[model samples]
Target: MLKRVEKAQQKWGGSHTVIDNWLNERQELIVLYCKIAGFSPYEKKDQSLPEPSQIQAFCQILMDYLSAGHFEVYDDIAKACEKKGLESQQLANTIYPRISDTTDIALDFNDKYAEVDAEDLLVGFDNDLSVMGEALEARFALEDELIDNLYSNHAD
Candidate 1:
């Protein structure tokens, strides 16, 4: 995820302020995700689920990131495509429903685990996390493609 975000930044950073800020948010979100998932190298090798408070905090950041992508980033891209009369609209129309489905899964994951204590989460938590992680990976790939299209068509 970090690698994909870095590639996106390298390709599209500085082309527009919105894209730069969105990429920065993506970096922050990934860091939070890594920390929660115990994927941070700086953290210990304990692959246990984080505490309830940590999960709740992560959920907050996740919601914010999701909201920004839907409300600000996607809206801006659609407006830009409309302004430029680009066929990106068709791409967006194809991708948006799938992205929304992924968003639903993410939000469901957040709601399910946000308030779960570490002890309770130990039961079947790994499977839930695995599903959420896969959904997120797919979501990120779709989002990156959307960003690439937006940048290629509209960035100056």
Candidate 2:
């Protein structure tokens, strides 16, 4: 996580990298919680663990945390798009829906798994966070792409 944080810091300069690190921290926290509850992401599919009702409070907290993290990044992207130019309207619209989906997933998971205990829920929340991070990283990469494109066009 530290290495990723440093890489993000170097790559994105400041705030976005901090956001990336923040998301990464949540993932680490979830992993630690999983360890505390004695489950592995690699557990056998057929193996059954205890129900989630035993740790409903913790699950809710995690759900909220993840949901907020996602939305925060979404907000950041929206602000960036607004500043990028009038050309960003279409991109913002497309990305907004994706962010909406992310929020919906968070809410749905929180509701559906409301009864889940420490060991009962799926590991997909962690995966979803990772995917979100990657998506944001792609946006960061696009900053570089656009810059290069601008330079190339100017050279033409």
Best by TM-score: 1
Q: Give the residue spans of candidate 2 off by over 4 A.
A: 1-10, 13-18, 29-46, 50-58, 117-156
lDDT of 2 by residue, 1-156 (tens): 334434544544443563555546555545534542445663446554434553355455556555555566546555655666555545557555554555565566456556754654566645544454454344434433332332333222
The local distance difference test score of model 1 is 0.80
The TM-score measured for candidate 1 stands at 0.87
- Per candidate, the number of residue pairs that clash is 0, 3
Instruction: Check candidate 1 and list the clashing pairs.
Output: none
TM-score of each prediction:
0.87, 0.48
lDDT of 1 by residue, 44-124 (tens): 565556777777777777788899889888998878767665477888888999999989988998888777775673676
**RMSD versus native structure for model 1:** 2.0
Model 2 TM: 0.48
Which residue pairs in candidate 2 have backbone atoms (N, alpha carbon, C) closer than 3 angstroms, thus clashing? 52-116, 52-117, 53-117
